[model samples]
Target: MSISFAFLLKHIRPFGTSGYDTFCSVDLANFLIGNLGLTLGDIRVLYTAWRGVALSDAQSAAIIDCAKDVANARWGQLQQTTGSTVMFLSGIQLQDLSNASLGQSFTWRPASKIAVAVRIDGGHGGHHARWDVEGFSGNTDSQGAICHFSDLV
Candidate 1:
C-alpha cells in the first residue's frame, strides 16, 4: 500500500517521462490535508512559502518523512532539505518547482521574513524587498492565499 523506492524507480520513466520527475506542493498540500491528516494551517503556510518547489521523488523516504515531520512539528518546517529534495516548492504560476537529485532526506519549516510594511500582500499593492508581487489572492490568513515574488510579478 506504500509508494516504495522500487515502485518509484519503476515508474521513473527511463528518465523518460517529461514532467513526472517530481511532485508539486499544491498536490502535496491537498493530499496531506485531505488524506494524511496534516494540519491545514501548517500545510497552508508551508505551501505558501514554496507553493511549487520541485520535491524530488528521488529521496529514499523523503516524501513519507515529510508527511511525518509535518504531523510532528506542525509548525516551523519550511526550508526542509533532505538529500536532493530541497524544500522550495514551485510550479506554473506557483513557486516554479525544484526537483531533487536521487535518494535524499527531505525537510520543512519556517518563519516569514517578509516585512509587512515593505512587502506586498494579497496582490493588493506594494513591492517586496526584491521581486514584484502579484497573482496572490485572499487575505493573509486565508488558506488559499499565496504570494508570488518574481520578475514578472
Candidate 2:
C-alpha cells in the first residue's frame, strides 16, 4: 500500500560568503493530518540536506546544532496532533557547495545554482491528488524550484 504525503519548508536562508549560516525547521504533523488525512502516529519524519559551504569548525557545529533544533521543533509541533507518531528517519545526504556561490547576493549565474529533489510516496489511492507546496532550488530566482511528488509502480 502507498500513502501520499504533503509538506513545506518554512524558513530557509540563502547561502552567504561572510561565513554566515542559517537553519530552518518545518512542522510535518499538520501536513500529514490535515492534508494527507493521516495521524501523526502513522507517519514518519525524514530530514535531508545537501551540505553547503563549510566555513570553520565552529561554524559546522553551529549549523548542526541549528538543524537539530529545527528538527526537534518540528517534532514537537507534530506531537500536538492527536494520535501521531514522529518517526525520525536516517540516511541524510550532504552535498558540498564550497566552490559555488550559494548564499551570496549577486546577479544570476548558472554556475552557482543547486537543486534539491523530494520524493513522496503515494500509495494506490486510485485517484490523482492535488499538491500545492513550496520549496527552494538552485534556480529559485529565475525559474523557481518546487517540491515534486510522484508514484512509482
Candidate 3:
C-alpha cells in the first residue's frame, strides 16, 4: 500500500537541520508528494540512505535537490491530489517568552486559516521552532520568527 502524507512527514527529519533550505521533514515530504512525484516507498529509500550516515549539509541538500529535479523533469507540476488548502503566513515573526522551556508556546493571529504543515524560522538568530495558528514551541536566540503554514483542508 502507498504511504500517507502524515506518515511521510513523521518519518523525515528537519529539512534545515538536514541541510535543506529551511524546510523541515514535513515540507520535504510535501515536496516529494506534492511537488515531486514520489511514492512513500520511494521516499523511504532516500531516508534510509541517510538515517544513520553522517554527511555535510550541502551533500544532503544535493541529494534531495537531485531527486526533486528529477521529479520536476518527469512531472510538469506536483499538484495536490487531495485538494488540501495551503496557506503561507509570512511576516508573522514573534518573540519567545522569557524563561521559557524548549518548545515554548507562542501565538500568531492568522488570516482566518488553519494548517497541516507548519515551519518556523528565527532568522539570524539561528533559532528555529514549529508553529500552528493557535500556538508554537521552541527556543529562540532572539524574539524574531518566520512562519509558514499549510492547511490540510
The candidate scoring highest on TM-score is 2
Q: How many clashes does each candidate structure show, in the order listed?
A: 28, 11, 3
Best by the lDDT measure: 3
Candidate 3 lDDT score at position 150: 30
What's the ranking of the predictions by lDDT, best on top?
3, 2, 1
RMSD of each: 17.3, 15.3, 14.4
lDDT tens per residue, model 2, 1-153: 111222223222223323122221223446646775766555433222322422323234334443344444545565422111111111121112212343322222233232211121223212221112222232122222212212211
lDDT of residue 85 for candidate 1: 11
In the range 36-112, model 1's lDDT, one tens digit per residue, is 56788887675443222223332324333333333233223333222111121222211121221112222211122
The model with the greater lDDT, 2 or 3, is: 3
RMSD of 3: 14.4
lDDT of 3 by residue, 37-147 (tens): 888887777655434221323234443433333333323344322122212222121111112233212343334332222222212212112224443322222333222
Q: Candidate 1: which stretches are off by over 4 Å?
A: 1-26, 51-153
- Any residue pairs clashing in model 3, and if so which? 15-24, 103-138, 116-150
Estimate the TM-score of every prediction.
0.22, 0.25, 0.24
lDDT against the true structure, per candidate, is 0.27, 0.28, 0.32
Please give the lDDT score for candidate 1: 0.27
